[model samples]
Target: MKKKKNLKKIILILVASVSIFALIIFFCSFVMIYQDVKDNCLEAQKEYGDDCVDSLIKIVQSQSQTYRLKNSAIWTLGQLADKKALPFLYELDKSLLPQKKCDLDKYLCKYEVQKAIKWFQKGNITSWMYGNRESWH
Candidate 1:
């Protein structure tokens, strides 16, 4: 009986440790993927100019994409600074506000939309991070 109990406990510990590691890995993947989406969108905006618009919009609308990725797409739209992007950026800004109160990850999303709108208004279109960055054009 004693040996059987020790074996059961060992099995339980192994299963628990595996479950915790798997959860950690899954959650970490989302964090990494979101950051990658943001960076890649920014790079594409910088490199492709107006050509990136359609693809970025698709990412924003795609069901598979996360809020973090959509937010990055919104920022890229703002950075791209095209008049065509105004409505999308504005819509994102409107949608983001309510989410802010419920989700902590939304602060960047809210900030990016507001900054995009501000730059869109100013006709400067720089990132909120540097405000008045050297023009990409």
Candidate 2:
């Protein structure tokens, strides 16, 4: 009887161990799936460009944990210049240097590059907010 009880306890422990390991595997798989979807969404926005208006809005509103990804999404939205992305762009612009590790000046200059591209695409020479040093505010 003693031996039988010990065997049952061992079996239960093994089952519990396997269950915990399986749960870990499942959790990792779920995270990978989530990342894949996120990457696909970003790529889709890049492919569709201005046509990705709704996608850009969705990305801006996404509860992503990564600041860089959120900022990149906002930058992509700004490139689209949908105006729907205005609030997010403004928020990202406001939070840009403080949250990111990169040099503030460099980051602002990068944003200017994108803005310049956007202005040129629209043929709006008067919309030169990028070169205005005071506009980083």
Candidate 3:
């Protein structure tokens, strides 16, 4: 009976150790992915220039298989939204992509353009505080 209890204890410890290891791996992967998304966002902003918003949207929409990538894409898109992208954003879907609108808008790849517009709207409110007050005069 004592031997059986010892074996069970060993098994339990092994399982716990494996679970902890898996958690550590998952957390490391998440951190790595987050950093990658941040880098991609910065790159999209810098390299794409006029195309950065569209490129970012495409990256987010295309990489929808991973929740981390998808979420980052959405966040990035929100950062770069523009009015020109709305029509395209409204058109995409999941069948063509993964996170489409109407479950289908994923096909349209202008997500960042749409998102950037929204960000612009919000940013515009603060613009008034910083710009030349003399310009109005």
Candidate 4:
């Protein structure tokens, strides 16, 4: 009876450990996949030029897009550092600044727009690629 109980405890501990390890792997995979998509989008913009920028601008302008999607578009524009996007970005930055309190979804989008505008002004496209989020806000 003692041996059976100890075996069961060991098995339970092993199962729990495996489950946690699987979860960590799953999370890391998801992050890698997301980063790959972003990297691909940036590459596409570089290769395609105006077409990609136009599409990203449309995404930013689209009210139908979720805040996350819009924020992604804004970040991409910042990365591209195209002069054409500055007007639209300026408009967005100004619009977001009036709101003292942002809903959770809009807050990050607002921050991204602000960052993009700064990047445009400073012409710091390279650093924006590997930007440290802590210094921006």
How do the predictions measure up, each by TM-score? 0.47, 0.36, 0.43, 0.51
Per-residue lDDT over 1-137 for candidate 3, one digit per residue giving the tens place of the 0 to 100 score: 99999999999999999999999998786656445545655665554443545756665555444445454555544433445444544554323344344222433333433454456556632322322322221
Candidate 3 lands at a TM-score of 0.43
Model 4 agreement with the true structure over 1-137: per-residue lDDT tens digits: 99999999999999999999999998786566446435635544454454556767876676676776667777777766768788988888778755555554655457788788887788862533433322221
lDDT tens digits, residues 49-114, model 2?
Answer: 533446645544566424455445544444334455565555555654543235432234346434
Candidate 1's C-alpha lDDT? Answer: 0.64
Ranking by TM-score, best first?
A: 4, 1, 3, 2
lDDT measured at residue 109 in model 2 versus the true structure, 0 to 100: 34
* Displacement of the residue 69 alpha carbon in candidate 1, Å: 2.0
Which runs of model 4 end up more than 4 angstroms from their true locations?
A: 1-50, 98-108, 125-137
The count of backbone overlaps in candidate 2 is: 0
Candidate 1 regions off by >4 Å?
A: 1-50, 98-108, 125-137
Q: What 10-residue stretch in candidate 4 is worst by lDDT?
A: 128-137
Summing lDDT over every window of 10 consecutive residues in candidate 1, give the lowest-scoring window: 125-134
